[model samples]
Target: MSSDPRIRLSGVEHTFEGRSGRVQALDRIDLTIEPGEFVSVVGASGCGKTTLLRLIAGFVHASTGTVEVDGECGVVFQRPSLYPWLSVAGNVEFGLKMRRVPRKERRETARRYLDLVGLGEFADAAPYELSGGMQQRCQIARVLATEPPTVLMDEPFGALDALTRENLQAELRRIAKERTVLFVTHSVEEAVLLSTRVLVMSPRPGKIVLDLPIETDPAQDLDTLRTSPAVLAATEKVRDHVQRRTPLRQA
Candidate 1:
């Protein structure tokens, strides 16, 4: 893997032309994600959490400041954007195909990621055949098959049921063990559970309000982690910071 910072944003600010006027979505954003760090971004709706993720993913360019990424980047959105015509294996190999990888290697690479995400048995199945959580899992496998050094996630589990969300969180904790991840989510507990560092953002023209380092045992099972006193206390603390900035309706 490369030695450079996986992601770096310096004095970054983004503005878009709105119906009323130019609206700034992010302001003076400065962040650096080292290789192998899991960073979670939390904010109220309209606070530019998605915008930040998109900026790092290179979907939208920042109006000001430099955003640098040292290696390949992949994104998994809240909604799975799978190809219905393709089978599970095909979907996972799509990026490799785009990169002109040979068919034999593509199939092998796809199988590895599918199995990593616990969907090896569903290789030949259609995307529609899987549940919402399972479909999202396939999306993750597709991104991972590309062997990206950085993964940007826009609340990939936001739409799942509570149980499925928890299960996938555990799966993600395992999959991103070595890569750099920038995750945006509304759930405080989810952020606390999966992140090495958690960032809280302001209401509008979003800026980092708090950047907290989380220290927890990753070896612990999900059930144990959820019930641990330290985890609960950290969850509450992060929740309090968010509640103070986010509107009650959003909270």
Candidate 2:
């Protein structure tokens, strides 16, 4: 792990107008993610998991505190967002093109990332032609094509069926191995399967209530890893904290 952090949040707070009055989504959110580390945030709904990602992505300003990001960021939203009119490679190439990369080099680089995501053959396919899983993978390749050192993912596989979600989880585990990843997910298994560390947040007006370190070699078989005693213990701990913070819902 690098001594320096790739992303840092200091006393971070965020609030915005809701149907009612201002809703305070996050409070005193102090966190640091080092280079090449996979960090996941898990919380109940309305706990500001998306708000946290927004803070880092600069989609909205924090009502208070500061978020510092060292390098460019690539984001994968809960809903797959791809250019329907563009082919797979065109979508991937779009990012580099925005950075003003040469046309020839952009296509080559986009193809490389497409290949990395196992979508090389579908480079010319339209987004609608692919399955939901394939489209999400294409979205990922598009992000990777931009070569962002820090990636913020807001439930990249949340909509997929269990089998497809699990499959993409494995794929993401592979692709995110060397990147600085901050993922917001509601699934404990997903968090355990992918993150080096998992932070459990309180209910709405969220803040880190528990930070659990996952112990398993990234190269280990995921099934075996999931069944590992360490993982169960950590999951139990995280779930316990979440349960304590959660009652019947009050948004």
Candidate 3:
């Protein structure tokens, strides 16, 4: 692996203006994410967690400072974003198709990723035909099919039922082993469970309040890891920074 960071944000800040007035969303965020790390951001609602992801993904530009991503990014939003008219396999192949990849190569790539996400059986199924969880899986497959170096996710499982969310969490953790991921979620436990590092942001005009490392064995099972002392302690620390609005720290 290269020594350089996969993602970096330097003195980053963002603001949004509307009919009402201007609202500052982020403030002085300096972060560095190395390759092959799974990082999660957790904060109170409206704390600009999503904005941070958007900045890195280049969906929105930072009002000041610079945001750098070493390679292309694949973003997965809270809701599944598959085209209704396309079959699951087609949705996965869409990115390759847009790039004009040869038909045979793209189909093979689509099938590979669909199977990786456990959606191979539903390759011919329409988006509406699958349940919410399955639809999300298909969306994830589509993103992975593009083979981006970095993945930015914003509350991808937030709307799912508790059981489904937990299952997907495990699946994501497994799938993220070799991928660089920046995940944003409101759940502290989820952050602790999934991330190699957990970042807590202060309320609106968000700043990094705490940057904590999670030292867990990736090979360990999620259920067992959940109750482990290390995970519990990390969860409490992240929750404290988020709930108490701890002092600012550069991430």
Candidate 4:
């Protein structure tokens, strides 16, 4: 892993004007993501994990402080959001096309990433023809095709069944071995399985409650790792922190 910080957030805050009043979504957030690091953000619902992702993606501006993303970033949301009319390879090349990459280079890069995600054979397939898992793989290929130094994922596999989610989680772990990834998810198991560092956020006005390092071997199988004592201990620590911050009514 590189020693330099790939992304930095200092005193980041955001609020929205709701019918009731102004509601704070994030507060005083300070984070640093290092090059080639895999970090997971976990918290209860409404903790602004997605908001933080949007801020980093440049979709939304920070309300209070600075968000400095040094390298290019690719984002994947909960849904694949692939265009049905586009072939798998076409979809993967969409970003490159938008950036006006040469057609030859676009096709070459698209094929490389599709193969990387085990979708090379599906290059000509349409989104509708794919299973949920396959479509997510295409989406990942699309993101990887951008060749960004950092990837931001917001609950990318949250909608999948347990089996599919587990499968993709393993694939994601493999991908993270080659790139910097910042993923947000509510699943404690997913966080423990894929993260180098897990950031636990507090509820409402989200803040980092704990930034815990995950020390297990990154090469361990997801199933075996989840059952390990170290993984269980980390999960419990995160669960306790989130529970302490959650209101009794919600708990």
Candidate 5:
């Protein structure tokens, strides 16, 4: 495997031109994400978290500086953008089919990923038939089916219920174990739990203000890890950065 960073941004800035005027989304951002790292970004609303993900995903161009990704990357957005008309299996296979993989090969690959996401039994079901969490799992399975080197997620689980969100977070950790991930979320705990490192972005014209590493062991049970001192401290540090609050000093 190559040792190069899977994603790199150098002095990157992005601005949106609107009827009112130009609005800057990102300002002079420099970031490097190495291969096989799970990095989560958090910030207040309109901090350009989504914009940064889009720039790396190539959905938009940076106004200045450079955005470089080592290879093809898959994206999972806030909504599960599945084809309602297609069966779960077909939705997963869609990307592979576009690449012209043989029908049987793509079908097998789709089934394999669906099984990975715990949706193997729902292969024939329409996307609408599944619950919200299942739909998101299908969306993830679709991305994994393509075998991309990097995955970019923009608040992918933000809409789900509390329990479902946590469940999906665990599933995501397993599913993305070996892949390079750039995840954006508003949940500080979620970021701390799932990321190898968490980055806090300043408000609009966003700049990364804090880059905090998570030292909790992934092997521990979720409950144990969640309550661990390391996890709590890391979460607090990220929360403080996002809220722009200083830690209390003790005598």
Candidate 6:
């Protein structure tokens, strides 16, 4: 990883004004993401992981402090979010088109990334014609075609079945190897599988309680790593932190 920070959050907070009153979603978030590093955020539901992603993507304003991303970013959401009518190549070229990339260069770049994700053959097919996993591959290719220095993924594989999700996770690991990746996920194993560092957040007024480093080769196969003791140990540590931070309900 490069020494330079690609994304930095300093005392960041997010709050919503609800009818019930003020709801604090995140509090005092201080983080730095180095270039070409992969980081995952794991926490209980409604703990503001998605909100953090949005803040980084500039979709939502931070309630306090700074959320800064120094490079261009491409985002992949939980859903494929492709244009159903467009062909796979067209979908991948969408961002480039918006940026006013020349037609021939856009096509070449889209095709290159589609091939990278093993979707070159599907270039002429509509997104609806592909399987769920394939659609996500297309989505990833679309994001990569833009050649962003950073990628922000919000539960991109969360909707897939276990087998498919695992496959995509492997693919994501490969794609994120040279880019700064900030992923939001609830799955402990997912965090273990992809992250170089995992940040665990406390629920409701979420704040980072632990930032655990994961020492493993990103080139390892996901399925093989699934049963590895090191991966299991890291997962257990994250799970324990989450369970410990969860508050018990009053009777």
Per-candidate TM equals 0.95, 0.94, 0.97, 0.93, 0.96, 0.94
The lDDT values for all models are: 0.91, 0.88, 0.92, 0.88, 0.91, 0.89
* Global Cα lDDT for candidate 6: 0.89
What tens digits encode model 5's per-residue C-alpha lDDT throughout 157-212?
A: 99999999988888998889889999999999999999998988888879888888
Tens digit per residue, CA lDDT, model 3, 1-251: 56789999999999999689999999999999999999999999999999999889888999999998998999999999999999999999999999999999999999998888888898999999999999999988899899898999999999999998998998898887778999999999999999999999999889998889889997899999999999988888788788886668643
Q: How much is the lDDT of residue 115 in candidate 6?
A: 87
Q: For model 6, how does the per-residue alpha-carbon lDDT over 1-251 read when each residue is reduced to its tens digit?
A: 44779999999999999899999999888899899889999989988899999999999999999988887899999999999889999999999999999999999999999988999999999888999999999999999999899999999988889888877887788877789999999899999889999988888888888888898866678878889899999999889887766532211
Model 4: per-residue lDDT, tens digit, 1-251?
45679999999999989899999999899899889889999899998999999999999999899999987899998999998889999999999999999999999999998887888999999899999989998999998888889999999998899888888888888876768899999998788779989988888899888888889986678889988999999889878877777432211
| Model 2 vs truth, CA RMSD | 3.3
Q: In terms of lDDT, which candidate is strongest?
A: 3
**Stretches of candidate 3 above 4 Å error?**
none
lDDT score, candidate 4, position 141: 90
Candidate 5: stretches off by over 4 Å = 245-251
Residue pair clashes in candidate 1? none
Candidate 6 stretches with Cα past 4 Å from truth are: 1-3, 246-251
Task: Give the TM-score comparing model 4 with the true structure, all chains together.
Answer: 0.93
User: Any residue pairs clashing in model 5, and if so which?
Assistant: none
Q: Name the runs in model 4 displaced over 4 angstroms.
A: 1-3, 246-251
Worst 10 residues of 6 by lDDT: 242-251
Candidate 6 residue-wise lDDT at 106:
99
Q: How many clashes does each candidate structure show, in the order listed? A: 0, 0, 0, 0, 0, 0
Candidate number that wins on lDDT, 1 or 3: 3
